[model samples]
Each structure stands twice: as C-alpha cells, then as structure tokens.
Target: MMNSKQVIEKIKEENISFVDFWFVDIFGELHCMGMPSYSLSEDDFNDGLEKLDASSILGFKSVNKSDMILKPDPSTFRILPPDYDPSRKNARIFCDLYEGNRAEETRFNRDSRGITAKAKGKLKEFGLTHSMWGPEIEFFVFDAINIYPSPYGATHSYGGSGYSIESKESPWAKGNASTAIDLKEGYYPSQPKDTLGGLRKDICDDLYRYFGIQVEAEHHEVATSGQSEINFKYGEMTEIADAVVTIKNVVKVKAKKRNKVATFMSKPIFGDNASAMHTHQSIWNNDTNRMYDPNDSVAQLSQEGRYYIGGLLDHASALCAITNPTTNSYKRLVPNFEAPVNVCWGLGNRSAAIRVPMYLKNREKSKRIEYRVPDPTANIYLLEAALLLAGLDGIKNKKDPGDHVEENVYKLSAEKKRELNIGSLPTSLKGALDAFQSDMKFLEDVFTKDFLDAYTELKYKEYHAFAQTPTAWEVSMYTDA
Candidate 1:
C-alpha cells in the first residue's frame, strides 16, 4: 500500500542494501537485474526505466533489434522474504517492457504485464469495473532428480516413477529405503503421510510477511510424493498475475534452500493425477459484484454471470492456447484426473469446465465462477486478460450458458451430453491453436495482431518440435517388432 516516495523512504530507513528489478520474458521466464539500493536515483522511481537487450528474451526481439527499456512499477516493490537468507536486505520490483527511454515510451507489443494493464483498462471501459482472480497453483516437490541423454534428457528423472519419494523431512524416510505415499492418495494427511505440510505453511507465512500476498489456505494435493496446493485471497487481474509469478519464484527458492525440487509441470506422472490452475474470477462495477444476484432464477447467478460463462465456453477452445499453453498441459486436461474436459458450465460440478460455486451461501459478494482448464505453466498475465475479454464479449452478446449440470459430467453418457448440446474441450495443443486461429476476434483488441501472430508462430514451432520427437513408447513398441 506504499507509494513510490514512501517505498524510497522505507528503503532508506530500513537500509535495504540490494534491489532486484524484475520482469518476465514473453515465455513467462523470470529475469532479474540487480543494483545497490543507494545507486538508484529518484528519476528511476519517476520514469520507471532501465535498459536491456530484448534479443536475449524469447518472443521479444531479433538480434538486430535488441535495444529496449524496462519500466519498473512502483506499486510492485516488495522486500524479499528472509526465510531463505535471514541476513539479506533485498527488495524486488516488477517491471514493464518498453521500446524507448522516455516516460511516454511505447510498450513492446509482447510485454506480458503491459498487456494485463491494457486488459484491465479495457474491462473498465467495457462496463466491468474490475476483474478479480483467485488461482490455486499446484506443484510437486521431489527429494532428488537425475537424468541422461535418452529422451527427456537432463530432467527425465522427474517424469513417470519414484515420485512418491521419501525425503529427509518426510517422516516415511528411513535413509531413502522406506515407503512413500501411495499414488493418488496424498490429500491432507497428518505428519508422516503428508510431508509437504510444513513446506506449504512456510511458503504461506513467508509470502504474506514479505510480499503481502494474502494466503488463505494451504494443504497437500492429490498426488502422493509432495504434490501441494495453496489458496490465497483474490485480487485484480494484474496483481493476481504478479502474485502468481511471486508464488512460483518464492516456492522454487524456498524448496532449493531446503534441498528439495519444486516443479509445476502439469503431468509429471502418467496414472495418478496432475497439477492444474483452477482460476476463480468475478467481474465487478461501482462497488457491486455483478456476477451474483440474491433473487436470481437459480443459485443467485445473474443472467450476466451465465452469459459470461457462455462466452468463456464459446471461446474455451481458443482460450486454451493461453490458459493451458504448453503441450504437457493437454496431458493434464485428459479425462479421469478431476480436470475438466467438457466445455460446459455446472453449479458445483468439477467435470464441467466452468463451475458456479455453491458455497456462496447466498452471499452476493462471494459469488464467482471457477474455470479449471488452466495450468501453472501458463503466462498468468495473458491468461487473466484473455479470460476477462472473453467474458466481456459474452456480456455484449448476452451469450446464454445453459443451466448448470449439478452432476459429474464425466458420469453422463455421450448420448446424454449430446442431448444437452454440450460441447467438449480441445484434446491437444495443436487443436487449441487451431481454435485460437479461428476465434481470435475476442483477443484482437487486447492482444494485438502482431502479438498474436508472434505467439502463434512460437507455439506452433513448439508443437511441431514435440510432435516430431519420437517417444519412448514408440521405440518400445516398434524397435524389435
């Protein structure tokens, strides 16, 4: 809640020696440039500018056009948590990417955070005062990882087996020869069975104390070998995206400091379950939550709420290119993992892509919808902005999302789904890309044509790269046959 002047005064009074000006490449990879706090002048605070080589970043610039500036947002400054290094007096500020050195510089078209800002402004302009997001980013922690040059080189050990590991802190560990948590059975056990509880609590505490992230709940996830999920209070689109990046960074650092490996890969194992980002969102205007109504036809979800869900479902396939951006993302979206595969809205139904939470308990302010098709690997800023835009379009068109399912959609027969006229989500990254190509109008205003073209090219290249690679299964099936 501190302004730039207040932040500067605090740094001086607190004697914070180090400051890391941070930003992300187009691929959502965190990049940091450091400087002594004393070296930063008031102009740095006013202009929000720093120079960098954009060519070094993916999806940014060619080698021939590498010059760029980073404009740090003053509101994003946070003192780095002292959990890992108690003696360090470090702070971090998130930056926006731009082309020129002046205060009125043009933002690089692919600046992910800049896109979020524009999207936030668009929401207000479109009659949605503010869009809020709450996401549970699931991840796994491993004792040790090793790999070689076969397939999955350098990180293959992380895939398939041995994930239900017994680490030093896990009560099940007896010098690495003890039993591990059984697959698909690691949800909320006490001390011994759930070894990740302490780590989750530590992360929650540190995130709140240092970064002011509002941590609400923390617990173990469905996967046995240290899969975890932490819930936090919702905020505006940009801040929530910022918190997502901070969450990933803080968790990775905290794990490393404890000799553990924390990974957010969607499908680390084949059978059990995979990590997902179930994002909850609501649109508000003039201090009123428009998504809910006390005297609605059903569940108090206003017509606007259903229309928004309709818009999301209408563009669900296209949105996947941003929400579930990676190839591994489809592996998590498949059937039987509690991840949604149907492009349908349901009241409290997990199998449906959009779930109208019944826990609102008639609290109009507590109303929102949860979209479960996303994963942690996504660029959060883009994903949040795209979702808001989709919902806005839905409002404009008054798209009608049929009444909620209220049942497990997976349990329904294919014929039954046909009877209800429900559609299914795309099955692969390629399919999602095609959908995005076809329905790009929803994103045109938010993600410019240039940005979309570049993003599509990069993603298609990634898909083809993965597609052409022969998998171990193929070799095992055909080498001797």
Candidate 2:
C-alpha cells in the first residue's frame, strides 16, 4: 500500500494530468471530482477536500447539515490506462467520507467506505482477523440501446420512461444475424459466435494495467444476448469493493469506446439468463481458513461456517433489500435461470441461496461459501457490511443451518420444501424491504438508525414509483379492455 508521500511522488513521476477523487454514496453509485495534478498537494491526499456538500448526494445529509469531507485513501491510487482516456493521462483514488473539516475529521455514518471499515472492525471483535470476498460479476454488452417515454394522453410525457436494447449477439438483430447466439447458449462460444470476446479481453487488460485488479477468468455467460462474466481473485472485503467499482467503470468506459453499451442491471432482458454477482466468502484467523474442517465427514464446513450460513439463511429475506437492491432484481431471482430462489444452503447445489463449492474439497484454503442471490447492482460496501454482520450474529448465537440439500432445489415439491424447512426469498423489492424492517437489528452495530431510515425511505420511493408506472406490458394487456 502506498502512503501519501509515495502517491504524490508517483503522480509527478508518471506525469498524471488529472486525478479523480472517488467515493460511493449510500446507494452504491460512484461519485467523483477531478483536480489537475499540478494543483494537488500532499495535504489533499492526506486530509482530503474539506468542503464537499453532502446534501446533493443521496442518503447523505440535509441541506442544513450538508458539510462533509472527502479524504483520499492513498492506497487506492492508480493510473488510468490509455483505454480509459486517450486524450490525457488520468488517475484516481478512492476516498472516505468525513463530517468535519481537515482540522478534525470524523467518520460520516452514511459513508459507504466508512461503513465497510466498521464492518471489518467487527471481525476483530470475534477473533477473526480477516474476511475475504470474491464476486462473480456478470453483465451484458449491447450494440445499442434506446430509452424513450410513453406518451401521456397524446401530450407531454417524462423522458426515459421506457427502454429497448439491441445486440448482434441476439437472434433478433437485423440483417447478418446468422452469427447470433441462440437462446441461453452464449456460454464459452468462440470468435465466430462470441463477438464480445475482444471487448472482454480489453476490459480485463484495463482492470489489470490501470487498477491492479487480478481477474481470474472472463467468458460468455449463460445468456444469448451478450451476457458475460468476469471472475476476479478474492481479497479483503473493502479492497474487493474498491475493485468492484473500478471494474464497473472500466467495463462501461471500454465498451463505450468499442461502440457498445455495457450494463450491470440485474434483469436487463426477458426470457433469458439474467446477471448476478454471485459472491464467494470466507473468514480467516491468521493464516488458517476458519470456514474449513477436514474432519467433518459431511460437507467439510466448520462449526463457524455452519453458524455463518445459518445467520445468512435466517436473514436472507431482509438482506435482499441491500444485496438485490432494485425492483428489476426480483425478475432475475426467479427459477430456471440458474438463479437461487430458495433460502437454503447445500453442497454444490446452484439453486440454493448458498452453496458450498466442492471443486477443491481437501484444499482447506480454498473452502468458502458462494452466495448466489446478489446481483451487481448492489453497492459493494453496504452489501458486504450487511452480509458480514448477519454472519457474525449467527456465529455469536451458534445458529444452525440444518442439513444440506444435495438435490436440485427447483425440482423439490412444496411438501418436500416444507419438510426440509426451506423458505422462499422475498418475491419483490417491497417484500424484501418489509423483511428488512423486522430484521434490521442485526445491522445496528455498524449502521445508524438515521441512515437506515433514509435508505428505506429512498427505496420505498423507488418501489412506489415503479409500482405506479404503466409499462408496455400493461399497454399490451389492458389498453383495449
């Protein structure tokens, strides 16, 4: 990790023209302010910009109490690749939010990065030194997209009211569509069928060269319309969160450069596989993996691991508000698309919410649980914090996850599900928000009451707006009636 001095020196040595100070809001959207490198000082890197207005940022603060600071975290300093901006040299550093000025800064409760730090600190209280996370971030690339408005009484209408997307990867593309990928058959197609392979490689290259992210693998995913997945090596939760933000930016910018549009929406398409950010996680104590146990004849999960899973399962519905945080996310959580709809844990069962990967069984270090319900739309910092807290609660209470279901969960009858005590995840964003209302005590250690209230209020606004809107489906179904 570089210190403030080192970062300043490197900026000069590398001749970076612009340096962006970056941070995420409570809703997980990235916000940035750029400064000319010549104007940046060591104090800017150490103490941060002291007068950022928080009222303009969602879930931050009211106008009366909007004063906030953006303290740059020097370790996150990275040079942008030429692909990101060919016109000029650019770099970025992630920042932590603070309420006070440079004289005496205090952590802002609604700050995404600060919240993550608090969550990581909680691990120390449990005798765990670190928690690692690996996210299988999935997305889609399209040739073009059009977003238009539904006419309102043949008069004025709000813009961006409806949307459509196009891709050469889809069978519906206009002429020369012979190379289009068949429905749900885009997995691992070669050059002829996989038009986005070069784009993925370029994205991976930018991630490594500019951001220092170690991408493990990249390929087409299970959707025919340019759905893709890029697996990155796991790291501490906060570091991984930073990488996630970087990955999304790199993907979007690089795709745009290639005359394509990339999106991380949970369900951007219909009747096809939707994107998910299946997260693999594990706790560590010193050099040992706390999630593994060689003597366990069953799934080889340690007691701690079982309890963690128990916590996750018990609070799965509530966690959805943050992990799957979009109205469209529910559309992807449905069955038959490799998405986990049931709140259960199992060994190698993809349909279950949590799966214990057995690919490297005896390798203790590789043992981890993969949570399949989360999508890329989530704010990485908030998502990881809530997940860790839930797991920690389970560990403290010694929660039991019960027997693992090895069979296909989708095939299980209602009676069988009831017999196994398996439960269903919330079917909509509203349902998930309701669950969060009852189960939010688990997050009290890290999240403030005011922050929770603001978050829910914003989400409710979104839910209500979506519920009240008229869609093309409604127009098609009930317009004549």
TM-score for candidate 2, please give it: 0.97
Residues 1-481, candidate 1, lDDT per residue (tens digit)? 7777887887898889888898887777799998888887767866655578888888988888788877778789888987545787889999888886445768888999999988888776667778779998899887765532355522466442222443443435566334366668777767766767788888999999989999989888887678899899999888999999999999999998888888888987667689999999999997889998888867888888888988999999999999998999998887888999988988888899998889747787789999998999989989898998898889989999877787788888999999888888888899999999999998888789999999999999999989976666666677798
lDDT tens readout by residue for model 2, 189-254? 887789888889988987887788999999999898789999999999999999999999889888
Provide TM-scores for the models: 0.93, 0.97
* Position 377, candidate 2: lDDT: 97
Off by over 4 Å in 1: 83-87, 101-104, 150-179
Best by TM-score: 2
Candidates in order: C-alpha RMSD to true structure = 3.2, 1.6
Candidate 1: pairs in clash: none
**Separate clash counts for every candidate:** 0, 0
Model 2 collision count: 0
